[model samples]
Target chain A: MKFEIIDYKDTRSGFGEGLLELGAENPKVVALIADLTGSLKMDAFAKKYPDRFFQVGIAEANMMGMAAGLTIGGYIPFTGTFANFSTARVYDQIRQSIAYSRKNVKICASHAGITLGEDGATHQTLEDIGLMKLLPRMTVINPCDFNQTKQATKAIAKHKGPVYLRFGRPKVPNFCPPDCEFTIGKAIQMTEGKDVTIFATGHLVYPALEAARILEKEGIQAEVINIHTIKPLDADAVINSVKKTSCVVTAEEHSIYGGLGDSIAQLLSRELPTPIEYIAVNDVFGQSGKPDKLMKHYGLDAPHIAEAAKKAIQRKA
Target chain B: MPEISELQAIASQVRRDIIRMVHGAQSGHPGGSLGCADLMTALYFEIMDHDAKTFDPDAINRDLFILSNGHISPALYSSLARNEYFPVSELATFRKIHSRLQGHPATKEKLPGIRIATGSLGQGLSVSIGIAQAKKLNKDEKIVFCLMGDGELEEGQVWEAAMYAGANNVDNLVALVDYNKKQIDGSIDDVLPLGDLRKKFEAFGWSVTEMNGNDMHEVVSHLKQVKSQTHKGQAQIILMHTEMGMGVDFMMGTHHWHGVPPNDEQAEAALAQLEETLGDY
Candidate 1:
């Protein structure tokens, strides 16, 4: 693996910009905001497509219902809110009106993970991916960086059915290729190696990349894969990578239980079982801190990932 | 419009199906289904511009109905089957293994008439509002009908949907609350009293109306009158007064039968009292 330093931006901004572009491209693309247009970067979409944008006040439950209603008449509704409000706040509404009904609704959530600093534990949501993925028809995506997030937003709008597109707020290094293909249920292999497979998603991808580079210097060649789509998981791709590596290190800015780490563990346990280590938020609430400080405190930084990868590789060896 | 006698006949048949289906499964909510028989019969048999043969689940032009109180799926399944959405014999598969007739309504099994899944309370209105909004966007002049259990109103999202419909003037939608005044736990009063439901809906800025949900004539006429009420700067809510288990004498006037199915002997007695009008499914 080669060390590549690159400029980065928050994936939430990519989602917001992509939403604005989607509104301009399609007349039927309607957006509903639950008092977080600015945070979600949906202000541009709202401003450009005023007629198509609906401000559902601060009522997230109503916004969810209205979005579902908008789907009946054949409008592809995109709902914008913070990750906390979008998942736990109106989970029942999403469960019945959207997922159960199988409405073609897009739930675009920003400020995911502890990257949303200062707002503290109440605002930071680490279990949204697990919540959305459990629904039968929901398509959950946690894109790693700006380019992938932007591409995922556009791609989800084109695909029918319910989608939960989660992105973080903090600016992270964009290592993915600018013209990379965004396919749901397909993992992107960033660096291929034989000692360990480091599967990562969302903001954690940058740390996994950094950890892979650090591990390379120590003679432990790590294979890094970006698992963007949590549901409709690419089992074949995961199994193939694990077969060669024999060990797995799962990383995400989410709870170790029921998050991306849990999904990977379940997959590996079923097919080509392997020893796996998790680099994620332990079972504890995050406190107010700077983004970098929170990442380190929560054991989600690069060194933590590297250590976890080393441990997993050692277990396999 | 379907003749009053024909709708009545359909309602009676729906009642038969509800009893037989619930009896066979030995599980399901029969009270709400029997209560909404007339309303569903009128909508499927007459009002809704739907087709039985070409049952395109997502056909945009036709009117859509969402059973928010999905425990009442026996009525919905019977209505779909009798209307020829699928073979009437498929009614035997209700709640059976691998059956599309899930205990609750679902689209996962590719059920012909079900566009969205509903069993959880207070969600149908929101879904109906979504379809209604879509209809407005596409210039589709069809109405979206959503039926909710009176007890389901306890869910806060129902009120949220009510507020959105009222605030947005979601006129192309009609939601009916089966005011049977009962829930799974007990009478709505015992569980959670929703005082002055009609007043609450009125306060929410909806064009409120009331009707005997069990009466064939009133159900048809009220729905007809309320049809054009949408787009008039207010949503419509018909507070349908119904007796839980209206047709079966044994189950009426008590919350005992809200979710529990009858034993074979009890089912026979219940079915014998309610005339087998259009023939059992």
Candidate 2:
């Protein structure tokens, strides 16, 4: 299958655009931010619907608690903040008030993982997916690009229970189809090949796609699947793709311990027990640098994914 | 308002329920539950404009109350059941499996009057402020009330919510601190002194009021006056002075009864002091 690159856009902008559209479409939607509207690209939503927006200042825990309460009055509240502040600073608040009670809240987290850049390890969150995954009823989504992120932002608003929507900071290739139907917990198969199953999420999917193209030049047929939603994983897709390939490679821009790779590993270990490889950050916090440089330094680029796919295929014997 | 005798009778019954429920369960917080018995009786019976018959999750045009410091579930469960949110006989099932009354107040079991869960400390004020904002947005004239413990003020998020409510002019909220001065370990003064909560909340932009929470007459009058003081450009906080355990003579002075259940003899002795006005479940 041939692929073309679309224009580059940040996934957070997709979330912002989705929020703006939600403001016009659903009057019950309300937004609360932790004093970082500009950073999260929420200026448009705040301006267009001033009455629905709440500037919650620097208190992320309070924002989460307030979001839970807003559900009592039949409002679907969307809370905005950095991923670190969104998850790490407020895990207990989210666990009790939102997840345990099953409140209709959308926790939109921008600047996830090492891609947050320049701001370094403190602002960058590598364990958010794992933290949210521990909650029983939380629906976790780490959409690949701008279009998918926007679709996910709108999708979670319609979902009744609590959600943790994760997106990135850097502008990546926005190649997802426009007007695509985004069903939560379903995987999007981008390319179909049989050599090694390549599963990716968030910022790493673009590089995984690019890696598939590079592998095809060398007669290696690598199938690439985008597992956007991490919690209610598409286990069937992972198992089916691995059934054909006999080996797998999982890629993510987060800590390999509890992120997408761990979920895929758990799925394969019990169901298929295939020899798998991973392309993710290895046991270290991120540092101040450009996002591209950080990706290359952290071994999360296309070449690294292509290498991992080859390693997993070689172990197939 | 209900007559003083009527309200006092309700409080006595709630106290009876608290001691009996805790004694029956063999494990519960009877001290704080008994401490806030009169407040719960007056608020649900005579003060707030809420309906016990037709239940609604939105709670539009109705007063909303949140138990922020939820360890005192016995008090809230007794009040909710006695006020007809559910069958009063269900109060006998406190802390048992499959019962709506949890060890901490929870909304997951579909308890009629509960809107949010609050087992962990210091989350209720933030949630109440959010509900107040919604009421203002929905053009509802009702007020939001939150009951917290003086020990819960040690949590930083309580102050965070306090600041947000004051700075944003969330004047439709009424927060009450159960100043029982006792925590699980020891006295709050020895554990971590709050250092003048009235002045502190006032500095955070609340219209502060102090009340004797155990006094039936004072509890009714203070809450009635404060309901009118809300929605006037300042939030309200009632620094209610209450004992850790108020009604029973043996449990009134110390924090030992904060979570200890009465054995058979202790139960009989404690039950002898408080008169039962309403029949036990």
Best of the candidates, lDDT: 2
Interface RMSD after interface superposition, model 2: 0.7
Question: TM-scores of all models?
Answer: 0.94, 0.98
lDDT of 2 by residue, A151-205 (tens): 9989998899999999989899998886877999999899999999999999999
Q: Which consecutive 10 residues in model 1 chain B have the weakest lDDT in total?
A: B52-61
lDDT of 2 by residue, B139-225 (tens): 999989899999999999999999999898898899999998999999998999999888899999888999999998899989989
> Which candidate has the highest TM-score of all?
2
Query: Interface-residue RMSD per candidate?
Result: 2.0, 0.7
lDDT (tens digit, per residue) of candidate 1 on A43-112: 8888888878888778888788778777755678999999999999989889887888788899999999
TM-score result, candidate 2? 0.98
> Native contacts recovered, in order, as a fraction for each?
0.75, 0.70
**Relative to the true structure, how large is the alpha-carbon lDDT of every model?**
0.87, 0.92
Q: Which stretches of candidate 1 lie over 4 Å from their true place?
A: A1-6
lDDT of 1 at B169: 90
Q: List the residue pairs that clash in candidate 2.
A: none
